[model samples]
Target: MTTDAADKPRAMEEEAPPGMRRVPGGAFQMGSDAHYPEERPAHRVVVDGFWMDATTVTNDQFAAFVAATGYATVAERPLDPAQYPGAQPELLVPGALVFHMTDGPVDTRDISRWWRWTPGAQWRHPHGPGSDLTGLGDHPVVHVAFEDAEAYARWAGKELPTEAEWEFAARGGLDGAEFVWGEELAPGGVHLANTWQGPFPWRNFEADGFTGTAPVASYPANGYGLHDMAGNVWQWTTDWFAARHAADPAKPCCAPQNPRGPAMEESFDPRQPQVRIPRRVVKGGSFLCAPSYCRRYRPAARHAQMVDTGMSHIGFRCIRRDPQNVQGKQKP
Candidate 1:
């Protein structure tokens, strides 16, 4: 299990939060030089020991939260015209980004070819109005905006993980290995994570036994016994989106301790200066990721997702940095 000293199970007297795994605090190289530019300049990072959810928040779990608190997800709430100037009133209604397979191979650059902003595409109606939780109770909840995730985390007495903490835990003690499992993406032709098998945006080979989202823990857990850290669905992090992790290792005397992302103002997409929406770093790619297209199913890989928006492939998990967040106190 490659258990680290800090992560090793303590005495039974220690109160471990249920449905979470303890990730030991330590320093390790972060980001990747071979992958996307955002993950470039692979630098060092150190994080404190924290308890992270074993799997992404599932539909059933989120339903319980909603049932108890009467919470309404972002996708269920109407958009403010003030926030989105020049937008049609009809378009401003409640909706979310939903994925639909194209008829055949088309221009992969245009994401709109496969994604539709369908009305009533909230967590309860994942596939739009006609869709319901039905058999997907075990699958990770989707169409949850950052605030929605934050609300759930607050309700559960937890917080979303920082990008570095998530990446560190996702590494599962393997450090800079290419894949979560190891160097080989799939050893012996085994599908380690639930990712797109065929070409994305058009077809899915379903080699991993799932065309869409798979149930949590459908694949083998990483070394830390954390599941769905690589694929199944992208997970939200607390860090704001930054173009690059340009921290020069040569300049820093030591690895940054629990490094955070750029400021909220700096998180806006430079391309869309007209829009003021901020972006957050979402780790772990989703089932839609394919080698033909987005190869982001690595521990170091990250994507900039708008804070006010959620897609069919986006979900999240929570972490407790201190015992006080859950239990009364930490045991000596």
Candidate 2:
């Protein structure tokens, strides 16, 4: 694998896709050993230059896709009994997992204490039946399943970034850095991203001035002029989730280039063989991440999300691999 992008022409020199920025690709350390075990064995990876969305897909943007296609998100479709063999019939309605802050401190280990499987909780109604995208046009769209995001990307003539691409962009040219901006979570007492300020599951100080998802680009742009690369919402990636990263080669020159993650079978949940839904890798932590609990607000942080599931904190962005298709934008 070549670590040099010296010969590869920069995407910016050519026309870039609309609403996206060119990310110059080169060799970078892909994972982290300082944080979660899943991010251990940091290894070098090389990816081709591509155009990535400056921010996550916004509510208005997804609405345009839905309006054009009249497509129904997975959360809006009724759960199939065949897919969930033992699920209760009454519980098999159209809905999604919503986050409800606990009244007081609860068991952080049990995520159910904070998450509720509420019916009628789709992308439009983020909280439940009563909630809507009232003033969230600029906020990142959530409650979108893997299929939903892929559909939008296809409709827009783009595709979801692979895990390696996402991590590379998230790093913002700062290879092996602790956080996106710098080593400190809040450098000079300023919150660079929208992460939880207080205890998890119960209290929130809103020190970042956002209790939930903030508008895209509310924070400073990264080295590549990309926004919300860290904490805002977990962005979907194309790679299937693996428990841990593959071991690096004995030689630095042998690093993998454009490496994909584990296959579908390897990404299946071992505990739930009955429901064989393969999980995808979701990059960047959400606003709910806190230091005391999930301190995964860094670029290397990743979480596994079931492809069939869509939660309030999961959303996505798109990327364009072919520079020749720069003129192709969202269809009218």
- C-alpha lDDT of all candidate models, in order: 0.86, 0.87
Sliding window of 10 residues with minimal summed lDDT for model 2:
323-332
Q: Name the regions of candidate 2 deviating beyond 4 angstroms.
A: 1-10, 269-276, 323-332
lDDT of 2 at 317: 96
Q: How much is the lDDT of residue 303 in candidate 1?
A: 90
Give the Å error, residue 79, model 2.
1.4
For residues 59-159, write the lDDT of model 2, one tens digit per residue: 99999999999999999997779888778887799999999999999988788999999999999999999999999999999999999999999999988
In the range 34-77, model 1's lDDT, one tens digit per residue, is 87888888987777778899999999999999999999988998
- The most accurate candidate by lDDT is 2
- What is the number of residue pairs that collide in model 1? 0
